[model samples]
Target: MNRNKKNISILGSTGSVGTQTLEVARSYPEAFNVVCLGANKNTQILEDQILEFQPQAISCDYHKELSTRGEIPEKLMSLSEIATYNGVDTVVVATSGNVALIPTFEAIKKGKNIAIANKETIIMAGEQLTSLAESNSVNLMPIDSEPSAIWQCLRGENNHISKLIITASGGPFRNTPVGYLPNVTPANALQHPTWKMGPKISVDSATMMNKAFEVIEARWLFDVPWENIEVIVHPESIIHSMVEFSDGSTKAQLSYPDMMVPIKHALFFPDRAPKSNTTPFDPNKTKSLTFESLDQDKYPCFEIALKIAKRGGTWPSALSGADEA
Candidate 1:
């Protein structure tokens, strides 16, 4: 209720990004206030968050079932309602897939700044959402590491960007032979070398499809042309991304593969905050940083995603839907 505190409503409070965002809030309690929390069906974790944060309102898909069992809170509200609530200054759209699209649109219309980690929503309706956010004077902040890194690299620059270089860890299968890729199991694909993420995203990372999605996301988030954006395999995952200016100089953002770093960056935009729970990058410990061209044959899914992105219609939405399925 402090006037100086940022009132936040996290839409996917139980997910990886959402929980990390809460960790940020916890670290800077005096700076942020949890106005609302929303999730899908993880009632147990949701209840734990509710007990800890004591938000003004909460939302979940199983609200009906909870109400029937007399376990629902009095402050229960729908995701859209939680998003546009009067007390919320920023809405963190961390839910996966298209679930956050309508709520995100509604929040933008209501003039709330959005700190979003959902790529599907952006890939599906980036044009519409960006235009709407611009008209409403709302900030559509990116919480994904790659786009957030690009954003950080462009913070103070005024020159035109020649290219935006996005880095990928190449996932667990970066060196897997093509002949043995079909034999790779789900457990093997989930073993990301640099970061710990959800199953779907980990699998996407292995297939390089996540990098492809990040490519499309960077295109919209930075308003850069498709041809101007590039991706490279950086197995070290130290440099999140880079931006090259028309003058031929490039700036890069480096960190030790942490999702919380980007989440904190997006939440505290236009200002830098002290590090919380994130490790400082140590250059001496890094042996070598290498880059390579992405092989289209090794990741046909990545190639197909780029094709769908270039099509630039409802095809991105279809791609997202198909991926979700």
Candidate 2:
């Protein structure tokens, strides 16, 4: 193991964000070392990732299947345990849903810099986690594209931010009539235009609930008030997010819609590496950019998430559970 390389443990190595984090790690082999990996119930994918990254510690919800792999610890650790494992210097919280909160908190408590892909973790316990990270003197980095965009826009701005404008793709049902919401089947909701994502998130996108969660996430990640955070439907997803300063000027982060861009940004903070697989924004290709306000009636989940965010405490936990169910 290279002494200088960042020793990382991924909490959700089998998921979309986890795989992309690995891709970023794969692109810069000398910069990062995979010290640990965890997965939920995807034993097959977990097994495959183990053969590749070869982490010293492993955690899977299914302990029996993981025991078959001699490389993984026979006494498999839980997500929270692997998160604060001694060898890991950075912990990437990529697990979806409320399950990520505990491990993310545990990692922060241990003073491990965190790259968080799971928005639910922030939505549920952003205040507590941010406070924990501050006390522990560790970084809690956002991996979601919108929050990352807000983060990028706020760079060196001297905390003069007046408002954070988060962008939304408006999802597949953007054009569907409000009267037809009840008719929306799972398959209908899953047809996302710009990004390929998992089913639950796909549904959330269709409902604009994903954007709402981001609103709460931005609130905690940037320590901005609820009124200071806003969302607009930008069907193209070219502009990830925007920030307005007290000086009355707004700056937005634009890139070709790619998760790897933000992933790389969080992994290597305050410094940018050359793009490996991500495409740079081309003005010639992007002729027009449009933004619109979200209709409250069409997307009730957005309102629900915001309501939960404002309520604070364990309300977000309930919101996450309701969304998952």
Candidate 3:
């Protein structure tokens, strides 16, 4: 297959995932270009990135910019603008919270490839986003590890996926003795043993709300039935997710905990651009992998998300909006 040099933009360009994504692009400078960048409010990093990649556009919520007097990129502004940039062939939606909801639609309507790292957007507006994507024939690649695994399994196979099994690290409270949960501090919750992410996401991981949000996202993103999706507590973070077929066979995607794998998959699918660093999975480094059922008493957010997904209306909007507030 002939590979085209793709132009890329990243939403939440200052976040952990976004920085790593830029690292991936730098790894393969010949295959990809950073066409645009969006961030909450961090002009220093944004300026540094702009100096490095020289994206055609940039967007900061206007809050993170310490020095507003500097020369800003002419195309820098709102997400809708980044999504529709003429040079933006792929839009990496790495922004946190619900902001990804509308931009996902905007990028897809323009038929731009969307590397979706935001779960709230789908939890809040899955049906609307996917419908728009379908109408416009866009690729909504799941940058989240688990969903990416599912996408890989479904590629060019007779994949009648019977069940979607999501693996979890069980968060900071995995062994915190249930009694200590009520006393869990924000500091303690911020300490995720497996993944390095933003504070809001780390907090959500501690509560298992992140997994719940993924469940809702998978349902709408792939048009899978609710019951087909299942969650398991895998203390070892190696197995991102699994898929069980109608033939009683199961397939899973595993790697050392890193967001770059999925991000790269989204950016260059049907082909892989050479990476600057090679971090292959080593089972010898990891001991045993265990799976267990989630204790509902421990995570009510899971049930609440399930309810919202079933209701299938603007209720998700209320949930996402209320949580954002």
Please report the candidate that would top TM-score against the real structure: 1
Error of 3 at 213 (Å): 0.4
RMSD of each: 1.7, 1.6, 2.5
Ranking, TM-score, top scorer first: 1, 2, 3
What is the per-residue lDDT of model 2 for residues 1-325, given as tens digits with 9 covering 90 to 100?
5768888999999999999989888889988999888998898888878888878878887857664554665546888888998868889989888887888888888889999988888877888888899999998888888989888887787388788899998899889899988888999988999999999999889888888888988888889999888888999999999999998898989998889988899888757875566778999988799998988888888987798779877788888888889
Q: Write the per-residue lDDT of candidate 3 for residues 73-117, one digit (tens) a residue.
A: 676578888878775778888887877777778788888978888
Regions of candidate 1 where Cα sits further than 4 Å from its true position: 64-72
lDDT of 1 at 111: 98
Better of 1 and 2 by lDDT: 1
TM-score of predicted structure 2? 0.95
Q: Cα deviation of 78 in candidate 1 (Å)?
A: 1.2
In order, candidate lDDTs are 0.89, 0.86, 0.81
**Count of steric clashes across candidates, in order:** 0, 0, 1
